[model samples]
Target: MTKRELIDNIARDGLVERLVANVCHRRHRSLPDLVQMVYEVLLNYDEEKLMRIHRRGAINFFIVRIIENLYFSRTSPYYRQIRRFAQHSDILKDE
Candidate 1:
């Protein structure tokens, strides 16, 4: 299937439905967009890493951070090409 079709499938899968909703609530983004994030990260990271973080039953948790870091976070290359994804994690000051 195409990426779009896979994303749609991810969104519709009942097991992930609420977890996807929770991620959307936390990140203030859309569901398919969140699924897209998972798709991208899945490309770069290994399935073992993803499964380790997301697990078979709860991938949405990982999807939230993936999307947040990839799109909204300002510190990493996710936001600008200036910083590397590994070396920059300057999110701080609230705690």
Candidate 2:
């Protein structure tokens, strides 16, 4: 499907809001940024993979997996280290 169609369907069905609400209730972070991140991931989807998902009719499963993976990655040590590195760089830049 095209980007416009994917976005339209997501918006019309409130998929992003539902996903964000599900996450925010448990993880108190930037809701808008998280939601944007999800969409950004979706926007960068590989067409072949998307087509395979469409063929399998497991779109919801795919989306939930993506979100769960993103959440788990955020809680991982590697993610924390990367975040800290970014923050350290930002602090250095400020000085």
Candidate 3:
């Protein structure tokens, strides 16, 4: 599938809303930002990897995995920072 098709499929499947709701309840509360981040991840996905994945017949699963990895990756310093920031903001709100 093309990139646009991939994004459309994801959104049409309600994965974006589900992801945002999940993360929001779990401490990452920025719904719009998370949606944008998901889109960014999709837009920047490697074409070769996508082709290989498309051949495998479970593209939505792969897409969800990619987004979940970016959102909650323990080893990714950038995602760690985002999680930390979200936690700190939550703490502030509780103050």
Candidate 4:
């Protein structure tokens, strides 16, 4: 599959949303932002490489890693944009 096709498949299946929900359960309010960030990161990859990863049955793993890193890594864009601004009480509230 091409980049567009793979992205369409992910979107059609709501893979990003599900992955974000599962991986960022404590940060539920960031769901939409995380999903969008995942897509942005995926969009930067080479299409042929993405297709190869998909063909190897590692696409889900790949996406999940992206979600995990984005939500958990302090240096990640997700942290810089969303997580950093979240107050401690807000995080506790989500939990």
CA lDDT, every model vs. true structure: 0.52, 0.66, 0.68, 0.87
* Model 1 stretches astray by more than 4 angstroms: 1-38, 54-56, 81-95
lDDT comparing candidate 2 with the true structure:
0.66
On TM-score, the stronger of 2 and 3 is 2
On residues 1-95, what C-alpha lDDT tens digit does candidate 3 reach at each position? Answer: 67678678877888776766664564555556667777777778887777677778776577567556766787644366577677777799999
lDDT of 2 by residue, 1-95 (tens): 77558667887898876876775464443455555667777778986777678668887767767666655576744346444455577799999
Residues 6-83 of candidate 4 have per-residue lDDT tens digits of: 899899999888878877775557679989999999999888889899999999999999998988899999888888
TM-score list, all predictions: 0.40, 0.63, 0.62, 0.87
Per TM-score, the best of the predicted structures is: 4
Comparing 1 and 4 on lDDT, the stronger one: 4
**Residue 23 CA displacement from its true place in model 3, Å:** 6.8
Worst 10 residues of 1 by lDDT: 81-90
For candidate 4, the clash count comes to: 0
The regions of model 2 sitting more than 4 angstroms off are 23-26, 75-95
Top lDDT hit: 4
Of the two candidates 1 and 3, the one with more favorable lDDT, higher being better, is: 3
